[model samples]
Target: MEKKRTISVSVVNEHGVLSRISGLFAGRGYNIESLTVAPIPESDLSRVTIVTDGDAKVFEQIIKQLHKLIPVLNVVENDDFLEKEMALVKIPIEEDIASIEVLCRAYNGNVANANEKYIIVTVTDKPYRISSFLKAIKKFNPKEMIRSGTVALERY
Candidate 1:
């Protein structure tokens, strides 16, 4: 059975490393649902969070392939972990501002930043929850939406 998985990879911060890593997935005909890469604070390394779907055997292949990359330092599959994704959605300012606010609250989200024309609602939750929030907000006709890649930590 295909299942969702989040993988955290630590890699050397170098040019083309991101592309090379992503290419590995693309070249192998695997789809990356979400990808987020950022440098570790005060370090010359980067952390990449990738979300993909595949069966257990396929997932193992993906991990083994990732490890073969030159820049990869470590890789961890976050199946047994605590994971969260953050998203900021910009909804147009209309007469339904109050209604939109209500929807946000219902999804464990909040209007973090607001402007005259658009309000930025933020949500931090599981990956599927984020998707649900986005789908629910579609009726509002969002001006822009941005989602962070999954960031996860293993549970003890």
Candidate 2:
């Protein structure tokens, strides 16, 4: 059966590693829902967090293929992963700024910036909470919104 899955991979920091890893999925006809990659702090490795929904069997095959990649150091299927996402919404200045700030605070966010034209509010929370924040903020009629890909780290 198909289900949402998050896989965290540690790889040597180098050029074209992202392309190669992503290409592996594309070559297999797998659809990646979200991907976030960044170099590990004070280390020669990087973390690549991928979110996808697909058949378990196919997913395993992809995992196996990932292991064969030369740069890949670790491949962890999220068993105890903590995930978070961030979002920013631009709302018209005419809207109630206080109310918007209140809403943002509810989602672990705050007014990131503001001017005479628009107010940008940012929130970082679990993915589902980010979705809920987006939905709830719709009542304010935000002018623009952008969400970041999921960043995950495995728990001890």
Candidate 3:
């Protein structure tokens, strides 16, 4: 069964590593829904979070390909884990700000600020929750939207 999976990779901090990793997915005809990369604090390594959809066989193949890359240090599929995504939306002040606030609150989100021309709403939640929130908020006519790629950690 094809399903969403989050893969966490540790790699040497060097140029082209991101392209190599992304190229592997592209070559395999797998779509990356979200990708986040950041250097590990005080280390010469980087962590990459990739969200993809595939069955077990395809996922294993993907991992094998990643491991073959010279810069890749480790690859872990965060199946038993907690994952979250964040989004910030700026909407024109045409809609009722109070109504938007209430909608955000319903999704465990918040309207961070309101100004004369626009309002900024922030949401941090599971991927689906964030999607739903965005869909719901669309009725207000968003002026801009920014989504952070997935970030995940294994559950103990």
2 or 3, greater by lDDT: 2
The TM-score between candidate 1 and the true structure equals 0.87
Q: CA shift at 17, candidate 3, in angstroms? A: 0.8
Whole-model alpha-carbon lDDT for candidate 2: 0.94
lDDT per model vs. reference: 0.88, 0.94, 0.90
TM-score of each model, paired residue for residue? 0.87, 0.96, 0.91
Q: Where is model 1 poorest over a 10-residue stretch in terms of lDDT? A: 92-101
Residue pairs in clash, model 2: none
**Residues 1-156 of candidate 3: C-alpha lDDT, one tens digit per residue:** 998889999999999999999999998898898999999999999999999988989988998899999999998886686888899999998888889989888777897888899989998898889989889899999999988999887787
- lDDT (tens digit, per residue) of candidate 2 on 18-104: 999999999999999999999999999999999998888988998999999999999999558899999999999999889999999
User: Candidate 1 lDDT (Cα, whole model)?
Assistant: 0.88
- At residue 69, candidate 3 shows an lDDT of 98
Task: Give the per-residue Cα lDDT of candidate 1 at 9.
Answer: 92
State which candidate has the highest lDDT: 2
- Poorly placed runs, candidate 1 (over 4 Å): none
**Candidate 2 ranges beyond 4 A from true positions:** none
